[model samples]
Target: MRLLSRPLPAALTIGLVAELLFCWRLTTPHMLVFDEVHYVPAARMLRDLAGPVNIEHPLLGKTLIALGMLIFGDGPLGWRALSTVAATGVVVGVHAMLWQIFRRVRTANIGAVLALLNFTVFIQARIAMLDGFMAAFVVGGLAMLLWAMRSEGGAVWRRWLGGAVLLGLAIGTKWTALPYLGMAGAAFLLVRRRHPDLWPGLPALAGLALLGGAAAATYFATFWPAFLYADQPLTLARLLPFQIDMYHQQTQVLPPHTYQSNWWTWPFDWRPVWYLYEPADGAQRGILMLGNPVVMWGGLVAVIACLIAWARGRDARAGGIALLWIASVAMWALIPKSLGFYYYYYLSSIWLALVIAAAFDHWRDRLRYWDEAFLAASAVLFIHFYPILSAAALRGPQSFHGWMWLKSWI
Candidate 1:
């Protein structure tokens, strides 16, 4: 229990356990789920020097998936193993960021645990999808930013550059990372403007250059053929057109599936996509797609609480973290993208953890009975939904109903 007294050790232990849990069902039912079909094939093509095809996403995530294929063969487990690792990386990165922000060992530990208990993170971590990787890179970038904010002089420059590099890596994983980069940059600029005497222009320039260089390197490294065929006889005139075409394809409507839903309904959790397993057979045989009702509902309340706290200037750290979380999720709502799903809330889980951590902090000095009761309740909810989240065999419809607290979940 002494480990709990130190945030870093506690976060590391929690991250390791989360990673193990994510990897456990990595190969269940042994088949492609959702977008894995597109990604797996693209990864296979990556192994061969086949001409670059029109893939909507950036190359880093597919590159990571390709790495898994190279190591474990082009199988379900191989493609998904990396996702489990990335998911764990996210948990670890979030822990580091929280510890840095709150400077409280218990708050950081609670944040990591809340992330583990989040059904969305757990389910997505176990699947062969890009969200987990996206989460990792995003959190990694945030952690570096926090480090930069906390450091001094040359150390600050180094951390700032590292944060920029990770931000590029995050963009490589998903385009959504761009908004976060913009937000972080704006925040940095405001901070710099407030204390120009403390900021170094040369270091800031160097960090920006390093970030741009890393992004360019990673971009071409993954898509070397684009550079090689730049002037070839059969080469496409430019990469931009090909990218546009790919974007169109991804955004366009596709064949009806059980979970395909409109973006408007996603926030309400109207329909969640089932990413894996033999659904036709029985409950125990498949992984059900769902988010934790407690976290999801609690997050909504937290969002409101966060706004009020920020308005009152009470607990600025908690309020600021909550605001960052809300901004990240709000991007999805503003985007014109089609077919958003519950898993898209992966980034929102960070905010969810923040809310839960803030709540714990509020109760920390209260009567022990309240604290014990809340902890016990959270544990029960986590255990109750563990089976469906992990794809463990369930009794039948009864099992599906265990976590399907809302009619919308079906």
Candidate 2:
């Protein structure tokens, strides 16, 4: 029988297997990590509110978390399931985006592999947080937007609309997604300005309108608490004020958190927040936080390579996308936000992966040997750090040493 004739490739199969195993391991020590205490509570309150509490963040991620709570009963698995699924979606989205960009199966597979092996993506996915979901939606939206750009058909409007809606969802997931949307808008204007014949202004305007409208409606709908309070004619006036108060609450720096650090320290991978644990139970207690060091450090080289390639115009598409990612990641540095952590570097990882994948794609033909060597090295490093990064069992000093790489990390 040819039923299994076209089985999945080794790389894809391995990646999927790793993701599943990691998910299982991650779910093991499922206590609320980091800001999850805030998000999970907010999600619980969402059901009770007539309007949203006006938290600085949009509601898509919280909504999904709520869904998981509904299904899984608000346990660690229930709260984190959504994040895991979203992380998986990010892997798929990266693959789909690469496929659209390179128009080759191998390129897409490579991109997906790199993303799966990414420490930030892996660590963030297993927790009950909004970053993974935001990354997924933003990357997914980018994939759709790229497809729309490449497509040449009468139904292109549908593709454009899909991209816009996804972009809106991305914003709903995280405010950080706004920069990507702006980039998309800028890219559209540049592309349209250059070739007016290919992309008309009307469609672009319509697409933006649809995106903005959908996003606004979704945002308001998620604020159930605000609406309920606004039900009374007199209380309606206080609705906006209530929302403003919530925003203030999110931005306000309360007491000091052990993990809190300045944005400047993030890029160096300093101050990673401990998200989950089951105590040191001799060994095999399982830890569930921290990104892989190999991928994070190696990305530095890839970032440099991408800059050179983009500067030389050798891989303009790859360069442009990398720049977009960098711009988004750099926003944290530019902002005046008081509280920051290593995980905030998630967007930076996305940029790094794109650049790395682009470099690999560009040099695959010219430097096959180097590509193979780098891939092997990356794999080994990821494996080496897997136990510590994922919080698997380790002896006393070894476990402590794992986190002692930098003074700031401690």
Candidate 3:
């Protein structure tokens, strides 16, 4: 069979298939699972003009969920429909970024496939949460950034402007995306130094100001719902108190969660968080937030290889991905809050998928069957763990025993 090598067709196929997989019986376990309790209710509040819910984080993610719920009745499928779509967007966006930056159709297709198979995204896609939406926008912004670097004059500036807006949307969805925005600005400066002809006479400061201003404006605009509250006037004075509360809410130490883990242990997948585990009428269901071991472990090797390659000879793509992974993990280290979770690695996992794709391209000729074999193994692991990932009913309590390979996973 001839493979689909065209970027749009390939990406769209990946996205559609993923969405179907995610949406299949999406209403199963017919109750709020994991963070759904937090966001879904918050979305309903926004839809019905109730007071702000989950104000610690920004509102766009919940607003999108609310949009879906408003259209469809507020049920499992309704709250999660937007998440399903955004997760699909992440696949397409990453595929576009890979295709545009490397211009290698084979590599880009493999990258998209790897992303779909990776459980970090796969699990999040099935649930109603902010991480999937944030990841989508990050990929979208990066795709735009890469597209801008390859263009000339007005095209370049337009893509940059669009990229800034998307990144701002990401930040509005979750504050964790801020480091990525800063890294994007740094990357812009580096690329501009090399390709001065892209925007010939534009001052670097002026260009940065434009991008920053656009991003800031985009972020502020997402707060329109907050401004429109009946008693709260649409004035800066009212916004300041909400902003202060939001800041304190995020920084203040909260009661400990059983599943919390430090940033150091995330790459190892040492401790998996159980987002939902409920004993129902007939049987028990679960949604264990975990990464596919094959992808997580194999991708780590690829990350090391990319860093080595970048150090030997400056491979801009490899260097940029490595820096992004580092930045995503590093920001958590500096944050005052002591609690962190595995899901915080969502942004870095995109690079991990890229690392696997790069490894495939790097070693395809040397070891013809390795990439294909790795893909097969990844698919098998995903299937083996699907029951837990999707909150599917277990035959018995012992059903989860074998899958918990790590004691910490229990």
- What is the per-residue lDDT of model 2 for residues 289-316, given as tens digits with 9 covering 90 to 100? 4555655666667677777877885676
Reference-based TM-score, model 1? 0.86
Write model 1 residue lDDT over 153-212, tens digit each, in one string: 787777777777777777777777778777776666665665564335334555556656
lDDT (0-100) at residue 347 of candidate 3?
72
TM-score, per-candidate, Cα-based: 0.86, 0.84, 0.95
TM-score: the better of candidates 1 and 2:
1
Candidate with top TM-score is: 3
In candidate 3 the C-alpha lDDT for residue 367 amounts to: 62
Candidate 1 residue 364 Cα shift, in angstroms, is 4.4
Off by over 4 Å in 3: 1-3, 197-203, 231-234
For model 2, the stretches where C-alpha displacement exceeds 4 angstroms are: 1-19, 47-56, 195-202, 224-243, 254-256, 277-289
1-410 per-residue lDDT for model 3 (tens digits)? 24467777777878889899888868877778888889988888788766766889998998899898988789877888888888888888878878876788777877788888888888888788999999999899889877776677688778888988998999899988887788877877887788776555456887688678888899888888876655433467767677788889899987899889999889888888888777754678777888888988887888887787678857767666766677777788887676888888877777777877776666567768787788899899989998888878888766778688989998
Candidate 1 residue pairs that clash: 284-393, 284-394
Candidate 3 residue 19 Cα shift, in angstroms, is 1.2
